[model samples]
Target: MSLDSTLHEALTALNQGRYKTVLKVAKSGMKRYKSHPAFPNFAGIALSSQGKHRDAAGYFKKALGLDPTFHDARRNLAQALILLQQSDTALTLLNRLLEGAPKDPDGWYLKGQALLNCGQPRAAADAATRSLELNTRQPRALNLRGVARNMLGDEAEAIADFQTALTLNPNDVEALVNISLPLARQTRHAEALEAAERAVHLAPTHLNARLRLAMQLLESGDQDGARDQFQTILGQAPGHAQAIEQLAALNAAAANADLEPIARRALKTAPRQSSDAARLHFALARMARQAGEQEKFASHLTQANGALAHIMPFDSDGDSQQFESLRTRFNAGADQVQAPAPSGPTPIYVLGLPRSGTTLTETLLGAHPNVCPLGERAVPGVLLAPFLENDIAFDTAACAQFVARDQERLPALPDGIRFYIDKMPENYRLIGALLTAYPHARIVHMCRDPRDVALSMWQAHFSGKALSYTYDLAAMAHRFNLYAGLMAHWHSVFPGQILDVQYEDLVTDVDGQSRRLADHIGLKWVEDMAHPERSTGPVLTLSANQVRQPVHSRSVGSWKPYETMLTPFISGLDPNLWPGVQQG
Candidate 1:
């Protein structure tokens, strides 16, 4: 028999949960074909069975090098790296697989899973969407996409995706488990409870679902149920990280209403040397910032950064090429301004530098009974890219062609909800093409103090090439300036449609800014709009926790803490625009 055949038999046994058989077959295969691709594959299986995960990763890497098309080896390598607590490497490999084989649903699904692990929701959604394109019936791909959407701040759409996945395959444990994640994020205790129970029935050992149920119960102010669930999970898998962390958090939350205190307690008590500290600290800092405790928040943040910074190096493309290409394609002449009528639906884009309150703004507008929030979906830029001619010329025919194509896919909505909000913050770079396509769409560009916005962005890990300037501070300033110039050009091209709102102004005088925002879109001031901070829909963005609280200028001068480190990046930009940096 061929070496691959022997390796396949061993893999089949491993997939069938016969670890002993896997060991036996794998050992024989490894001894006979030590230098072949199947040799490494079998060796990886044998090492993994023996709990030697690092060694298994090495073997899988060798197997992949020997046979680049051995996707199974890459997948196995990624999982093994995860076991070794090397999530960044695993995610990078998964991303490579996704791009190399866009038609492979499994590759996309794996990339989505890795992205979810790393907390980059939009990229995960993009991968999942690609996976769906390849195999619409792929329940796992659909479920993963739903998870990504839910994380990116679209609760209703996420629910729809999960529901669709379940319709396709009734026994999808991950889908059942994830259904409750969005509910918890939205603070829907009752619905989350039902979903949690269903998940447990479908998968008796579904830790994440069980953890979600416990968290929902706790957050709903049900201590007894929360305690029981945590204890039950501990009984099955002692020292389970989720149970320990969530239980501690539950205990802390029960003691104080502010949540920051509880978060601090959890961080102190969490076991040292675990890779989860970064996320925990990130959660704490956001809550603390909300509670108006800058010092404590900064401390937790320092700790979190220390943990994640080691692994989460900015993974975005650093090239200025995509932006240049995009700009060159849609150099629509600025002299002609097409007068827009009150005919088609207005595209109200909530644009800003990422992490500078776009989600908060979207939620604020979405709370208005008249608007539908299409959270962070970069459809406008994605729409215009193909239609624009290569030399900055607008092709009206091509633009019209794409608009018709897109309008067909937009979900049907109820009456009185006329305006649609595309909250893609990075769309600030593409406001020019956006006007050419819609002509009638409203653009709300949200700006914060450059330092604060840059700092907020500095700490955050964005997934797109649009925010590629984020890794270096000077680069960020230059990009921000370019964006400013672009927005200026957009205003010159189509004046009166683009409205600028300083994020600082928005929070400082929310009622006043909101009124102006409402009037710009021609909507009357509604009392419910102010309650956007308390929006109960699943917010699927990094700001998911932040939007649930009232707006504040607490983040202003936020770069003060990192002033020393940011000096270079600050000096690199146009200093006059951002006044926070020390002048020479």
Candidate 2:
């Protein structure tokens, strides 16, 4: 057939959804028209339509080689590269494309997807925004923007974007799966789980959708459901590292048959610095700890944290500057903001370093009849961000604005609820602002042994960049020192306003400390408060499993087992923070 007739036939077949006929025509044409880029490009489209990205990439590359300036072939090549998980290369091609066609919304959207894949969420979000600005009706762009925003810690904006995308296409599984994260971050686990379930329902064969559903199930305290979902994933993709890691965590205590071995084998092949490696190592570390293989535990923990270091390295200078900024703002106790009295439930701010018993404390408080636990709300951090970022005076006027906004941000509390808890451990940083905004609010500071806190933080896998410092022992110690200094400042500045609950003391004498905490917060001591394990509410924090059991002192000296591996943390800590451990 003549080249014109061949090209016309191939185009017609491609446009008619006859991918096989298009491919056959393209392959036949490629031999006769060796210089024609269209033949190879057509073959690539057909192959990519059939989900053969690797072969599609080769054909697209050949097409690009034939005609380097062919924009259509270049765009197709970039997309194939992205699908083949070569996002860095895709990004380079996309940057060149966007430079030539600056107004191309599709180019911006592709760049956004590539950036998101490459872990550049800020850049990805910008790209998505540019794309959306150019073409507001693109649901995929909105979905991409939501994913990026979620990664950048803008959960509210991310959810809004996802909701907008869903409104555009209710069957968008990608939007449904992506929305679960920010929803879960806001402690709306049920909604998150529902979103995940819908995604899995829409795309039953999508591994990521099922994986997310499994995670949501686990977080929602449906362990059996999570295990089944994970098992289902493994049945299809046996080498899935995330599934192996999560299943390992579920079966760690029981030491399920061959489960540890399976996890160990997966860990051997996973990329050294990937989150998968971190998760697998953490799971193995737990297994080692459970089996009393302390040395193995130390090794796995070290590797786990090392992997996280590559992904989210701590910023010591930034953390110190933040501490200094907070000190400068609240050291002298700013004039109390004269905002109107809050008519809602008085907030009980549970503040401390992560893994310093904040979850346990919150659980105890939540057991109270009048106290509703709103787990780890980002209200304070969000409120403090503008002031900190812009260097605005957090004076009486700013404080009044903060108080009014704080009230506005909170969900409506049910009637008869006397106190609600916001137990984000890092809220300790904003205690001054929190009190300034709500003078009637109660502050409970959880104090744990610095060694235990450091070790625990190192072991825990936090969801976002907010606690990235936990990956580095020295960074955790530095933050701990800052926490120490800040707590002392709060005590001096607001004498008798904040209650210090020693985690060790609380665990050892649950009854006594529980009453003390209840009294300090003006809560009537209830027998239920002493036994938080009886409460069947969702425990979404890292200490989820431990909190569901009766409070115990086993974790008190937990650092002793890994004392030899904790040199970096030990060296950076203030001696006063080390309660009873002998420092070398």
Candidate 3:
């Protein structure tokens, strides 16, 4: 075929999603037109479509080298850079593109995405807004703006933007996926699940859509459905890293022995230093632990954490400073701030370190008929931002304003619902603000063995910018110490106001502990509270799988197996706070 005809065939194949055919055509065309940019560009597009981002980036660079003015090649290269987590490099290229074509909506949108990936949400929002102004109907721009807004802690605005994007392009899988996040945060799980299902239905073959659906199902307590979706994805693409990892997690949770071979195979082929490889290594670690391969488990766990750490280094000093400041400030006026009046519906704050029993506690409380669970809402953080930001004194005026703001953001509870649970574990840092706002509000401080909490956090994967401390063992221990100190201060100041529910105690005596919880929250002891597994509400936390199962002591002393690995964490922790763990 002629060179032009060959190029046309490759472009056609690319448009048709026939990546292999495009690769074949591009290879053939490159032989005839050795220096042509189009052939290499087409090859790059094909590779990128197949998720070979690094390989695609190399081809895009080759295309640009052949013809420096190839704008499309530059854009494609930027995309690959972003996918490869080189967001700074991607932003530099995107900025140059936007400078030449200031009104290019696609360029601005790409810039926004790069900025968002780099954790510059404000800049991302600005870029997305500029894109929207240039092309009002740009659905991707709207979705990007929504993501930025969500990251900026403006969930309502984010939801509106996502809805607008969906209206513009109903089949936009990203919009559907992005919309579910804010809904889930607001504890609107049914709506979130519906959005996830629709995204999956519209793009059954799309890996991200299918992954989102599986995750939603898992969080909604449908493990079987999640497993089926994951297995289906694996069947379609055996090397799908996320599917392999999630399936491994599911099997580990259920203690299924069948996933070991599959996980090993995937780990062998998984690329190093990528998020997928990190997750796969984590999965392998879990499976190794299950198989009684202690040394192998430790090796895989280290590899997994190291991979992610290389990608996103945690700011341990900044995190430590922030924790120290929060503890100091909260403790200083712990007894001075007078409690505000009871609001419309009493708020129940379930606060603790991440990977503690917060979700399980929330699920148990949510099983009560008059209680509603709002999974990890950011209302407390939002309400306290002004005070925290400006170092404003905690007073009745601030407390009243906070109460009003909180009530405004809270979703309408069902009739007869007396309490709404906000299960943001980080709210443990904001206990003083929370109690000052509404003293009548129930605060259940979920406590677990610090070592177990640290181990669990180190072992698991988390999305978003929060929980940076979890990336390092010493940081995790330091943060836990901060949490313990803050909790003690709150208990001393509020005396009997904060209910301390030890995870170990709760697991060993569910009925007894749950009855105490009910008494603390001023509710009648209900049998359902003891059986959180029977609760039908969605659990949007990492503990989703654990909460779906009946309460057990399996995790009570889970840190024992990893005692050697956790030596650094144990050493960093205060002996007074974590007594027995030091010797372990």
Candidate 4:
């Protein structure tokens, strides 16, 4: 065949999603038209579509070698490198490409992907934005920007991007999966579940789609469905890192020793510094802990934290500086608020540090017939953004607007629900604005032993960048110190408006604490409030499985087991925040 016909055939096959046909055409075309770079580039694309990134990289390199000016081939090579987890090398190539062709939208998008792979979400977001500015019609660029935005905790903007991408391509599985979590976090469980379900339907065997569907199922309180999804993934790919880890976590307390071997085997092949290895190692650690293998647990836990830290590094100094700024501004009443909304469901703000009993407290409140627990909604931060950016006071009119916006943002409330709970742990940062905006808002400050909180956070696997401080011992301690200082400031400023609930005290004396919580939140204490295990509210936190069971003292002093190993975390914590625990 002539070169023109050969190139046309390969390009047509590629555009039609006939990857296998594209490979066949490319192979035949390359044999006759060896001088053409397009043949090798098409072959590389086919290989990449078939999940053969290493093979794709070889073809792409050959294409670039045949024609040094083949920008398409260079971009494809970088994309393959990204898929192969060689992000640093990919970034280098993408940088060189962008420098030469600064107006290339594809180059910017690939650079964003490379930056995202390198854990530079902020930079990735900027690169993605540049691509979109150059070409607004690219759904992939919009989706890429959404992923980066989600990582940077810009859920509202991320969702907007995802929605726009879906408008462009309704069957975009990546956008569907990416948007689900933020929607779920916003308490729009139905929408989240719909997106996840559609992704899985569109790509049944896609690992990420299945994993996301399972997570959405878990978030929507469909444990059985979630378990089925995880089991399906494991059945298809036994060595799937996230599937093994999640399934193990779902059944950890039941002594799911069956998964320990799979996780152990997967860990051997996963890269030492990758998130996959961290998850597998954490799974094994959980299994070891369950089997009473203390030393084994400690060893795996240490390795997991080490691996995770490589991917999720926290800027302790930067975080501290920001905290200092927030404390100073809030202390000076920089964003003072107006009175609470006159008529609406009373807002209950459950704020604290991660793993500080926020979930358990929310569970207890959710059990109340009149309280609707909007599980960990990110609305407070969104509502506080305007005032936080400016040095303006939120007067009564502004407060009314704030309340109106919050109510509109919230999911449709069920009939007879009088108190809507926002149990985001980080809501502690917005206490001042939250109180001012919602005058009748009740604050429940959940406090736990700093040592235990630090340990729990270290062992936990968070989804996004919001909880990245938990990946390191020192970072966790630093976050705790900042959180403590901020909470102290809020307590002094809003005296008697906040109710302090110690986790240990609550777990030990469930009845008394339940009464205190109900009264403080303006609810009548009932027997149902004591039975949180029976409450079917959404449990999207890391403690999802643990919270479904009866409240127990098992996790109260969990830090004691690794007391020696947690010296770094303990040493970094404030002495005054140690509670009843004796610090050596």
Candidate 5:
């Protein structure tokens, strides 16, 4: 008395607009298979129509378990699990089914849906693409693929897919909502808003469309528009955590109009966290150095250094080898250069490890009317390529010739843009070659607490930066010490050209330290040097957040709380670099 055939026929009928016969035949067939697998599933599907998800899920799961290879049972089980908000398990099962039918267009389409719910979009895009390759007419696959592609950062492909999905099915809310995000990513605010508004018009209660629109409005400085959108969401869900958290943070930020007073208070108070303590000590040290308080500056610098040394212990020998290995591949000696400096804006490179106030320094210098701080550039390394005698990294003659030919594509020397800042921290290694390229080009090497730098690197997420060494504390320590030893090498190689500005001094006395920097570059300063970010606009780096804000002395000695986690790294740290840390 199996009802498998009847239920299969009913789904076929249902999918083909035979609703009356589907319900009647499905009901009649259900009575015949009292306890059959298809009987329970068909019954569950009917029950789901009446909003009986709890009962439907039990039947679906039982049917799926009884017939493991049953495609309909598995598909229905996934749908049921989705209804119960168990998307992770549903996605896993759906993926398994998809793998079995790898070339099945419909299977790939369903797999994409499961992937979207699981927030595994990068994978979802591949599945969706497979679906389209098998059958280009799959509208659901097109729409889901568009969503997946958007998540994968392929904005152009995503827009086309979404448009095609709309052509196939004009009322596709998923396609409409998915299209707006890529537009936003492209910074096309008005177009994104227009698309999102159309989505809202089509589906008045669509939450995602409203949220995306709200974010764009907020970014465009339409605060009232953003407020209205957020308020509408809160009206539907009073305890929405994301909207609530954003609202709370926004309100809190509004309370503190300026960062200076808070930062000053933080500077006076003893830091509770290791990170906080490090920043304060560094700030105090910098201030002491600037006020010509030699002993106090030395003491504070020692303290700041000691605080950092505890986090990343040095590996002198290993780092020396690693540093040499990189140099053999990248460094350019003056002997490698045969031609004169390529005509262009005089390049000024600012080099240091992360969290060493590179941004602060660049902003201060870039604030001068004559200088343009491009933040970080691949061009310096590009320009220095021909001079670099790294036989291991390139076919030396070919690489040198390639640079000679394409050197003109570099930034045209704009009027008054005399000194260009290339503040890529790793450029410290390239200072030798850079000096070889343009003999008169200035270089600034920023010095900070090695341990603090490592600690900061661990706390931050640098997107896709390839310094895999930063994750391990001991590795970070080794890298920092290695970097320090290299700086020592640069000092001997290029005497009187490189200026070492300790970060601790800069924070303690911004005015005085800025003067030293100005003197090095032979430039006069303006009153705006007091707040570099406020004056040095056109930032194009991760430091944008820290630089957009005013000067703050809250980052020194910031690694103290994580001392326990940092101990492993500290043991290997260079004792000389952070004497205060070793003392602790």
Candidate 6:
């Protein structure tokens, strides 16, 4: 056969998914036409199909060197680069492809995927939108856009996009898997589980689908199911670092000795300063702590946090400036904006630093027949964004606009529900705006010991960039100080409108504190409020595992074990804010 016929045979084999056959034919063609780009490109495609991304990238590079304008080779090379986690290079190549062929929807779609992997979700969304503009029926673009939207904290819109992508191509495993995230975020766990299960069923061997299902199971409190799923993933791909790390975490509380080897292996293979290494180290730290190896625990914790700090560096100065601006704007408008009379079912705002019993309080309240719990919704931030944009002076008009916008976005409350809880911990920063908009809305400010709060924040790994300050001890302390100052300001302005619920007190005196919380929210005391562990709804926060168990005082002074390492955080805190606590 001629060289062209041989290349054609390789392309046919590739299209048929006979990757080995494609490779065999491509190698023969390459020996005959040694300098031809098509043969190398064919081999690259086969290697990529076989999951040898690094090897595929080298072949693709050779193809591009032989033929600079080979668009197919260039696209394949970019894909291999992305698969190798070299999104920066993939992005550069995709940009060149788009520059040469501006109408290429695939190029735009690939660019969107690259941008999303690079942590530029906003840019990814824009790129996905551009791709859809060129090819409206593109399911991949819709799915990519949905992922970007979810990352941007727009779960509702993200769900819509995912649904559209599924409609366009029901077999799209990524869409099926990704739709579960926003569904889970919305507290629709059953639907999320169903979506994840469907994704796994559709593509049983797909690592992402299995991982998504495992995560959903874990979040739904099905630890055994999640463990089985993670174990299966590891069995299929022993070097699956994420699965190994997650298994370590799942078993960390129990100090499962079997996980130690897996954790060590994952840590050994994971890239330095990568999130996977951080997760494995944190898991090892937990296991050590559980086993009472305090010295080893401290060492592992330090190493884990060091890895996280390197990967997700906190911008202390920028964060301080942002917090200062929030304080300045809210303080400036405190006198100018008249508090509106609260009407309708009053919103119960659960405001506090993360891991400070906000989830517990909300879960307890949500168990009541009269209250609905909306777990950590982004509506408050969305409503307040307009007021905070461009240093705009917040006034009565801004307050009214915020209230109107928030009311429109508010989800429908259950029948006979007296109040709904918005349990977004970060809403503490928006207490001034919240009270200004809804004067009658009950505010529950959950406070914990600063040391414990800082320690918990440091130990935990948050999913998004929103809590980057938590990675550093000093930054966490600084953010905590800002929170305390803002809460004090809110107290001065709102007076009796805000209720302070101490986490330590709540856990120690469950019944008494529960009654106080009930009275503050204008609800009659119910036995269910005292037993939040029995709550039916999903606890979506990092406190998911904690709230599922009975309230205990075990976590009250957890920082004591690591006190020596937290000197900077404790010393940096405002002593007055933590009454009775001595500064280091």
Clashing pairs in 1: 151-540, 152-540, 153-540, 331-392
Q: Cα RMSDs of all predictions?
A: 7.2, 3.7, 4.1, 4.4, 11.4, 3.0
lDDT of 3 by residue, 1-584 (tens): 78778878998888899999999888888888999999999999999999999999999999999998788898999999999889999999987877777888888888999999888887899999999999999888898999898876678789999999888888889999989878877767788889989988888887777888888888888899999999989888877877877887777545446766777777778778878888888888878877788998889888888888776777867766766666666665545567657647788999888888999899889999999998888667865876876778777777777777667667767899999998899988887778777878899988888888888988898876577668778767777777777778778767888888899899999999999999999999899999998988878788888888889998778888788898888889997877776775
Assess candidate 2 and give its TM-score to the true structure. Answer: 0.86
Query: Which pairs of residues clash in candidate 2, taking residues 3 or more apart in a chain or in different chains?
Result: none
Candidate 6 segments exceeding 4 Å error: 1-3, 21-36, 62-68, 239-255, 332-335, 338-345, 382-389, 393-412, 576-580
Clashing pairs in 4: 340-439
Error of 1 at 580 (Å): 7.5
Residue 339's C-alpha lDDT in candidate 2?
Answer: 51
Superior candidate under TM-score, 1 versus 2: 2
Evaluate model 5: give its lDDT. Answer: 0.66
Q: Least accurate stretch of 10 residues (summed lDDT) in model 1?
A: 310-319
- lDDT per model vs. reference: 0.69, 0.84, 0.84, 0.84, 0.66, 0.84
Of the candidates shown, which would achieve the greatest TM-score relative to the real structure? 6
Residue 190, candidate 6: how far off, in angstroms?
A: 2.6
> How far does residue 206 in candidate 5 sit from its true spot (Å)?
3.7
Stronger candidate by TM-score (5 vs 6): 6
Worst window of 10 by summed lDDT in candidate 4: 331-340
The reply for model 2, stretches above 4 Å from the true place, is 1-102, 114-130, 133-137, 148-160, 181-191, 252-254, 333-343, 400-408, 576-584
Single out the weakest 10-residue window by summed lDDT for candidate 2.
Answer: 332-341
Per-residue alpha-carbon lDDT of candidate 4 for residues 1-584, written as tens digits (9 for 90 to 100): 78888889888888899999999999898898888889999999999999999999999999999998888999999999999989999999998898889999999999999999887888999999999999999999999999887766567788999999999999999999999988876667788888999999999998899998998788657788999999999988988988888887778556478778778888889989988998898888888888899888888888888887887788887787767766666564564654746586888888888888888898898888888887777666756666766655667787787777677666667899898888888988888778777767899999888888877876787876667788888888888888988888888888899999999998888999999998898778989778778877668878787778887898877788799878888877777865545534
Predictions ranked by TM-score, top down? 6, 2, 3, 4, 1, 5
| Sliding window of 10 residues with minimal summed lDDT for model 6 | 330-339
Q: What does candidate 4 score in Cα RMSD to the true structure? A: 4.4
